[model samples]
Target: MPEAGEVAARVAERLGTMRGAPVSVESARQLPAGASRATYAATLVDAAGVPEPIIIRAVPAAEDDGGLGAEAEVLRAAADAGVPVPEILDVGLGDDSVLGFPYLAMNFIGGESIPRRILRDDTYAAARGRFVEQCGGILARVHRIDATQTPGLDELVDPVEALHALFPREFDAMPAGLVLATQWLVANPPPSSPGSCVVHGDFRLGNLLVDADGVAAVLDWELVHIGDPVEDLGWLCAKAWRFGGATPVAGMGERASLLDAYAEVAGWRPTEEALRWWELYATVKWGLICAVQANRHLDGIERSVELAAIGRRSAEQEFDALLDLGVVSPEVVPDPLGVEATVPDEEPHGSPSSFELLDALAGFLRSDSVTAEMSPQVRFHTRVAGNVVDVVRRQVLLGATHAAESAQRLAALGVADQRALCDALRSGELDGTDEKVRAAIAADVRARLLVANPKYFAVPHP
Candidate 1:
């Protein structure tokens, strides 16, 4: 694989060769780092002309990110269907040549992400409302796109099936509790929708580009699938994406307005029950997705505080889902996984493991060197390392208690064992056929979270 430097060199060479003049790299900036992909800000200038800035996104070849070509196809299809997006200049499916990573380049939409920064402002709040309106209008247009034209559209898995297929693999390497939760979710598939549209698997604020007026570009199509449109709305309104947590609505606008705008475009309103159901499902789905990344960190695919910090947010999401389901009253939601039963005040037996030692070392490095002399990026990584230690320590302290409770709860439901319970949960063996089983699983999960992190239970009030 080409290193970032090697890739940059290739980018410079490619621009120079294309423009027929020597091109200099004016600037290159890596955007907010994440586990799934890397993004870069690139500006190039040729001797014959002016500078042009472009955004470059690179993903691992193995990911093949079913979303890539599918997303490009969706954007193209949406454009024809009348939704707005950035002009795609080019997309590259890597072959160990070009850049050693599957890459896509698009004209950098000139705007900040449509987020609270705009939603909180008096001048921008009105625009924010319009922005949500635009999102609904745009999504309705996206839904109108002919799925047959989008590659892999027919292969798109329904929400339940997709979750069943991906969750085990995603959380396979994580703690047993996550695996258990994944099983329970798969087992309890909701009422399936006959309406399959080109769904933006990740339609949320952070993925959008916005100017002072409205959405300039809808970004991140990696998870785009031909599934239920309500999935998009649910995902958008999901709590995790509601950064700062004040926006009761998706991306900080009212959900009703967003839905009403969609009705305006589509000629029919999506049922509130359907939307709410999808929203609850999306919450668990996203939380499970985050759990996978947390596992990656635990497994050493990457050590990052941001990823571990994000792992903590999953409990918060579970609380939101519980509230949405009406299984728990908003004011009475319990503490996470009985955290009081976990998180110890003393060290464990025997010699500290390498992770623990590295954690200690990272802390020392943070205080003595990182905080004092390192660049922001280096400091950020140091904090990530520290956070990883925190997450691991917390899990080690709390996990066994939750796992034991989970096993007991599953057994009480007549599940022979954890694996059997997981299999039953994934195979639809416990849907309408097993209401008591589902209730038991939900109760156990709630109790586990209460024991794990209670502060997360309090949903942010507007």
Candidate 2:
């Protein structure tokens, strides 16, 4: 919660102590790194007028579960095992130390972590061509790190059980899709690991910084843990991480190319079915994660329009999991929000109604006049704000109809609500494989997308 200037000043003092020399801050600013933490890019000027750039990564003391010191150790282990990573300069674990939070300082590595530029910009065209092979090689190296030697690293739990606990907690109740996916995962476990090794819990385009040549350095070590090496590959290929790319491997290359490169480096390749099982598990994991993010706003942890909008995206992941498990497909029903209905000139509120004002706000937020001069973080938030406004507008238009339909479908299945329906799935009274259950799930997902993101329906299946 400190100001940017204050954070920069602490960095100067911290690095000064590390080097046993005077250091002064030249400049510092926050980067739009991740949803839950703060990352600062800072420059320090020595008394001799030499300049040095570094990265300061901080998590709130309340949220630093795996001590930042442990993360720093993992980074060193990763680098020693041939993985490209930023050099860790120092770490602070005490609340009163440095910036008054758990944090780490590292030498800065320059590259683009934004998927929009890396996937679309001409500057990274060559990177796009080689991302698959390079990512595979990097991930293989990541899995080679010896977790036993790494201090404070969390031993992997049963991933499916972890997700099962998370799902109902985040949503306040489980859905039929969750029960279906859980049963599928339990009944169809993947092959045992080659041996327990490191898994980068989140290894996708957002964390891989790519320069013109290729991946410059791997960033974000907070999620590193001891787990099956295949977890990294599955997390990478999750549909939710594709970020609008056409291909499956972080939108950069084909699945086969990634597996081939990984096989060449690791001396083995997982069966396609094994990979698919892991991928499905990851899809379910991401869905609940989106809900957890939304709750960060709803529960007042970090209120932001961005998180609220992302809450709706959990439905898309649920939809994807069902499609993967052969429980449902993208139904081609006409979008209800696309209706060409005329509005009454004299509305209940006024001449220019509440809906009209919402539309005006959305348009203004999206207008270049408003966002052209904003910082990258502000600009991204502005876009999300605009999308969130549209979601509100569409919900106002169709929420009641969607609610009625959901209730009717639940009643038809002899359940009182979604919660009861989920209970039925568990008791074997209602089958996930039944056509009626699939129909209800598909309809619920379609309504959600109609409000959250209508275009998601058009994203070709990988």
Candidate 3:
């Protein structure tokens, strides 16, 4: 809640013991990556003629009731266990005299986030392998520490419960098809064979501060919990976290290596089936989160274009999961024909610009909806509708329209309608083989991508 400048000033003051004299904030820049917490990099000058640079990470005052205290405790425990992490210089409840919110000051980690380059380039071919090793290695140590030893971290939710909690309350408002999918998932919960360990609730490449050698510090503990070790693995390799399309897992390492490294150090190798279940659960959980964020935008609590865009992608992942789960037939996917023709080559006919169109879409996304007075659940999806409309608008503007075109084309090609497609999967319409569903979803996604962004979809013969 504190202004960035104020938080930086407080951090400078807190570090006075380390450097001596009244510390003053020399500079501050907001670190822009997370959804839940606010972070800042602060440069401090201590009158003792010493230069001190510390990162000030603060949980908003609203979340301060227990999150920050819990994080500080977990970081302390991890540090004590020799897990690589920023040195915690000071932890505070924060006052008007200091920062406007509860804050923690840590030694500023120096290095580009490994994910900044590794996920996008081949220069870091070994980066993925090494990243996974460090994760498994450090987490192995984190698991070794007794949960009781970590102050204020007692009542942590298990992975299964956590997964269910992650679903958007608004999801109940989705079409009957999605509602049915939800019921199926709830009825068939992932197995909860319990284990005892401290789970890094959001451990993944992005959450880590890393460099060429390895992980500098495993950051972000707002979601830390005392639960099964595999929960961390499940979260780490969630497809949603894999910024890249599909090749690498979790935007870092190979899926097998991630498990292998953990098994090598932890002395317990997880079956691929077990990991698959968690991975699927991860997708569902993240899907719910996206849905929730979109709901926030819809409700006008937060209006972010990126959130709206990414939120719609959740269902794509869910459909992919159904394919993975063997509930749907693969190759029987509907073909694309009529759908591609409906999309205009260029809407608004190239006057202002693509950025202008996106800005217009953002504005439209924030406009008050006719369903503004609806129930909370309905309101959530009305928000989603606004976002989806913008996406269609963007696809129209950017010449990469994907989904609807594919659906129409599939229907034209003598494929069943949407209702039949859902029923076929639900009623064992195809031979009861999982591969069929997987193939079907893959084909549909490829077509949708083509419609969504044909420019990106276009390829020339070498």
Which prediction has the highest TM-score against the true structure?
Answer: 2
* Residue 330 error, candidate 1, Å: 3.8
Name the Cα RMSD for model 1: 5.0
TM values, all candidates: 0.77, 0.94, 0.71
Summarize candidate 2's per-residue lDDT along 1-462 as a digit string, tens digits. Answer: 456678889878878877889999999888863577888899889989898898888876345533577778889989899999999887887764576678888898999998888989999999989899999999999988877658667767787766655466864454566567777888889988678788888898788899999999998877778877888898898878788777788888788888899999998887667777888888877777788888888999888787887788877787777778776555454444467644434445576765678889998999989999998889988888898888887877777788999999888889988788877887889887788887887777777777777777766567
lDDT of 1 at 459: 54
CA RMSD, predictions in order: 5.0, 2.2, 8.9
Candidate 3 weakest ten by summed lDDT:
453-462
Error of 2 at 137 (Å): 1.1
Residue-wise C-alpha lDDT for candidate 1, range 120-172, written one tens digit per residue: 66756556757778888878887888887786664455555567577776544
Q: Candidate 1: global Cα-lDDT? A: 0.65
Order the candidates by TM-score, highest first.
2, 1, 3
* Candidate 1: worst-modelled 10 consecutive residues by lDDT: 334-343
How much does candidate 1 score in TM-score?
0.77
Per-model lDDT? 0.65, 0.80, 0.61
Per-residue lDDT tens digits for candidate 3, residues 207-227, read 777665667778888777777
In angstroms, how far off is 69's CA in candidate 1?
A: 3.2
Name the lDDT value of residue 436 in candidate 3: 41
Which 10-residue window in model 2 sums to the lowest lDDT?
328-337
